[model samples]
Target: MRRLAYIRALLLVGLLLAQSRPAAAQTNLIRNPGFEAPYSAWGGIGPIQVAHEWTPWWSEQPDHNPPWYRPEWKPAEAQFFPNRVLSGERAQQWFTFHASHYAGMYQQVFNVVPGVRYQFSVYAQVWSSVEDDPYPSVLPANPRLQIGIDPTGNWNAFSGDIVWSGEAPMNAVIDQWGYMVVEATAQNNVITVFMKTSPDFANKHNDTYWDNANLIVAGQAPPPTNTPAPPTPIPSDTPVPPPTAVPSDTPVPPPTAVPSDTPVPPPTNTPAPATATLPPTATLPPTNTPIPPTETPEPTATEPPPTETPAPTNTATATATVEVILETIEPTEGPTALPAATEVVAADSGGSGAVAEPGEATGNPPAAVEEADSTAASSTILVVLVGGLALVLTVVVLLLVWRRITGAG
Candidate 1:
């Protein structure tokens, strides 16, 4: 007896120690778990069934019940409530989960920690029609509890396939609410819990009801609704930068290169005029290319190192006489010759004007050199502009023609 008593005492002490160790307590995380409150926060089509069960006249729309209560299966009869309740009208009544129409409801829980296991559970019941003449009451093969991690925390997050489908033994009574519980780990901050019906039958009346949802986080305290305000830091001229601050310095350097690039193109274009004019002047036969000799006269004035006026005057006279002779021959070259003549004159003026520019810079005048440089630049720009425009027009016509050919083919 003493030995037996000692054994019993030891067993009792073990039980006591186990109890004192403090098993983890789980708190329900779901808000509005019961549909008793207005489901304004709830998402999807089904409305809150304000119409009570058992009351023959109770309806989804009590005030305007007659017009809206027509069920598709039984067109002759109409009721305010959805199908039939699981139990007597008073004991069982809630939202209906219709598989045919994909009717369901979902609620989002915020501030959920990622990679943490959570216990999710809900109470639901299968709904069937009352009249069984041709149509008998049908229960769904599978009902589901969908728990998911939605980064956006939107209600539509549960709109896709369930992370996992679950099932529970349903009672024969239409109003009996059964338990469908599941365990899931959140992959994001906002976890969505949904009560959904399965698409098991082609024409199956897989209607179900849902109430009393529970979400519990294991081994952690529930998040508080009102988070404490962060501590204000001491004022400093150079504050610690935010993690989200973009590197403004990196983008600034790229824009600086564009301005440097823009100024470079114009300065580079200044030398282009010198090249275009030098070719025609170097291949000088005043009649061969009507414009060069006219330019040669201007340079002769500045070209000779000594007796600048007399030598330059003789050259100018010779150039003028040659241009007159070319103009007289221009009419014989036809209408084509008129444009050629104008082009030759423009090239001669610009080329010769540019040649005198260096002398003006040294001994003559700064303003004269600037004027000559400006004239040469203007003529070069005009020629380039005309050429670029013609090239662009040709490209546009070709693209349109190609598109039409491809479309026709």
Candidate 2:
């Protein structure tokens, strides 16, 4: 009973330590990127090409830049400004959108990766035209603007399968442009855009203009967020070291003794018995009569055929193997609530950016995200409670069994 008590105490202490552990293990790591909104500044409009540094012209209104925007007139390389994706309905807004019209493509590969998501868009001209095809055709074979998985291998000109394809509209083609925005899988960082065919635009090869190519998070891992805090170039001055404290010697308590409770004895199932030696010379006669065996023919060794030695048979043994599996249980909410090493990734996801707290991370999870975390925490608590209850029930059952066996119930 006393041994059992010590075991229980130890288990309690262990569980307490477990509960007190910090969160944020590698297992809880999560990465998600958002959409890159239209760079038009306005809500919509596209199928325009910008140049100079090789950019794209955004589809915004009031600035037609054309009655058939002059080819030599050159436009701006349009890009989504408030880049990256939105979380959900409560999310600010998804950046992913599609393009409307098309002549050529503007393509570039970025060095910096923004957030955990990659952004891509498709533009097509349905009702209107830039070069204005005489006989407009809404063919399903409407050229696609592609984004391939070329890792800078085959640079300058992109080379790979067409990633962005726009479904051809019905025969109502007057020749105009449409838009479609999307977030690509973060695994591929390469970006490119070019018309699949030269139907409307005459010189498809030379006409595709792209500019203002901001490839955020191109080389580095995904950015914490699209609106990442601007980098501070100037380094701060060296911090002054605080003065070390001096130790003052006071009269220490002289060898105080700790008192221990007396150890309890374990209960025994049976009483100890006295021992005696057996007499070597005394031969006791058997009182009980033994049944006689029926007579049967017994073969002599010489009469029997020469016996053959038996082959070695496989021996079976009562053996057991113990295996330990480290099921690194992760908290459902995420990593523990303690500071992690620099190697651990922290999602600095937010439009506001992460403001460093005095001794903690500045970012707060969105309301939706917080709700998910709370649900996870409740689940963990429920599991622990059920486990504890089961253990207590087992102990009670054991006690009842002992009482019944000893007739002490």
Candidate 3:
């Protein structure tokens, strides 16, 4: 009877142990979570193959293509590495060789209870370098590693319904492992888990390794660990101080008045000396010099009154001779008879008597008449010159006046 009791007790304890175990250990919805299976070329995409239960995905946008698309260009490569495994004999690795890619893998998990919460986690590490330097002394190895769960069971990696976790810390030490976790409530009976990374640089050794992914039922949520502590309370017996009074409005001092004892000098009002208005400067008109009139010699009986000289038949020659006579005549205060008067008459008579007539005519009435005639001619020429000068002066004055009017306008 005691042996029977002992057996029953052992069975009861074993059932309790099974029931108390963590949900993660009891059920993991992920398949091939450790990546123990060999990666095969199943998908048509080249240069990288996926492990079992994972579908390879990448951004199809042209901008997301590899930086260099050479025939030998491989944006990413994935394979199973036995030496780098965290637990099992083999682990999965995805890397680039002087190239970068925005790609990852996903798996759809089904048979989940609707409205139940689920947690997805994965252990990942990165070894990003440049020029064979493990840490890339200059450039940062910003391989942003993260994991996500799409509660809607969507295959699209960029679906908005996906809940992503914070980036897994980059392992400064190679092969060092870190885990990223994200939780989501099941919207339906199916969910999708994703493992993704985007290395900022296309270095020579931008490598990442992932293993031990998990998705398990999350039971009752744990209490928040970061709840703020209640503020300290004042003691009941402590005395309270009244707040000091503050004026609602400050008073402004009035401006000081000038002292009556201080005298200010009065402004001098002496009128400016009246500007002397000198009469406008007198401007006298140009004076016209009076020319003495030629005296007419009275005709005496000894010489009958000289006959009026006939007009020369060749008027042009006569006029030219008269002009020559005027040019040769010297300036004098009064009209003086020119000796060349007979030559002038001779030239007007076609120059035939230019020399003979002056000698033939002695101190006779004809000579005196000729002298008188010469004087008359000089007077007429003087009058004409004075009139011409006046005309020129009038034209100059008009031009100056016109210029002044235009300038003022």
Candidate 4:
């Protein structure tokens, strides 16, 4: 009977042990879940950096090194003062010194049953500081912790179909571990699980540590809800009234008068004339006319013989005659042949003599000899003025012609 009792006890113990063991279907689908693998074992095929079965990922949007093996991925071994490992001899850790990062790691699991729901979870912690000084009080913003599952097994970290967990709650204690979990329905035979942390600020030490990533099959997903469309509103029988029109003659308030200390001038009673008026007989103030000094006749200057008169040429004949008259002027009382030089009878014209008697030359009275002299001087002055004006007019015409030719070119 004692042997029978021992057999029964053995059976009972076996049953208890069997019940305590986890089912084979519930085994972890991740490799190196605790990141206990040696650094030499960590490698990748191409651009990717693999930590055993997990691959590092980072947003290229921020300036960062390619998602390759970096010093930050070195395993965190336990130290004397503060321990980083949560379960085994080593844990996965990444940090930025005097910088910030949005980075994480993901593992893809295959052979998942489509339409089955699964849960992804991880334990994460952060230590954000300013210039190596821990926060005196609570941390201003703890590094955001999240775990996600992509049912479609997409490699993209920001895929729209990813199911993400709420931000893991942080505690006042520095380097305190927090739990994060997310669930999703598998749409294919493969799915991916991720562990991520985004530092709020580029602190001196923005560090994050992760360990014990886990994936497990949840129960079948719930049925999708079918919400009915909202009913459209029925039209009302009453018509909306048109806006009232403003009356054209509506009285507008007058502009406010601004007060000023300066006095305004009164309007003048006299009307402004249409055109400026002048005096009935406008008399200009008399201007002084300078009298020319009389030229004394040179007694020694002899009149040239009539034959000395140059024959009229096409060019400068009038000019030569005027010059001769100016040079050979003698006193009218003297029997000088001055009149011969003054009269320029063209050689080509049918004229008998170039000289003439003084009375017949200018048809002036002998008593008015000084007056004749004055008249001759006036005529010479007038001729010089006219010649100067003609020269100016010719120069202006030549300049205008030159400008037009250049403009056309």
lDDT of 1 by residue, 1-409 (tens): 9999999999999999998995555567776554432322111213323221110111122122111121111111114343332222221233222212222445677788888876565555555432222234443233332223232344542233224333343332234445555555677788766544432321223345554456787445433222122122111212121112222211111111112112122222334688888988887775576676776776455544444333333444444554455455434323333333334444555554333321133223444445555555565566556555655665565566555544543
**What's the CA RMSD for each of the models?**
32.4, 58.3, 31.2, 29.4
lDDT of the candidates, in the order given: 0.40, 0.28, 0.55, 0.54
Residue 217, model 2: Cα distance from true site in angstroms: 10
Candidate 3 lands at a TM-score of 0.48
Q: Lowest lDDT 10-mer window, candidate 1? A: 53-62
lDDT of 3 by residue, 301-392 (tens): 21322212212222334345545555555344332343455555545555444364434653343764566676777777785576556556
Reference-based TM-score of each model: 0.33, 0.22, 0.48, 0.44
Candidate 3: minimum summed lDDT over ten consecutive residues — where?
264-273
Better of 1 and 2 by TM-score: 1
User: By how many angstroms RMSD does model 4 differ from the true structure?
Assistant: 29.4
Candidate 2, which segments miss by more than 4 Å at Cα? 1-50, 55-103, 114-117, 122-158, 166-174, 186-190, 193-197, 200-409
Cα lDDT over the full model 3: 0.55
- Evaluated at residue 98, the lDDT of candidate 2 is 16
Clash pairs of candidate 1? 53-89, 54-89, 86-174, 86-175, 87-175
- Candidate 2 per-residue lDDT, tens place, 178-225, comes to 333333333344444332222222111112221111233222332233
- Which prediction has the highest lDDT against the true structure? 3
lDDT for model 4 comes to 0.54
Ranking by TM-score: 3, 4, 1, 2
Among all windows of 10 consecutive residues in model 2, the one with the lowest summed lDDT is 315-324
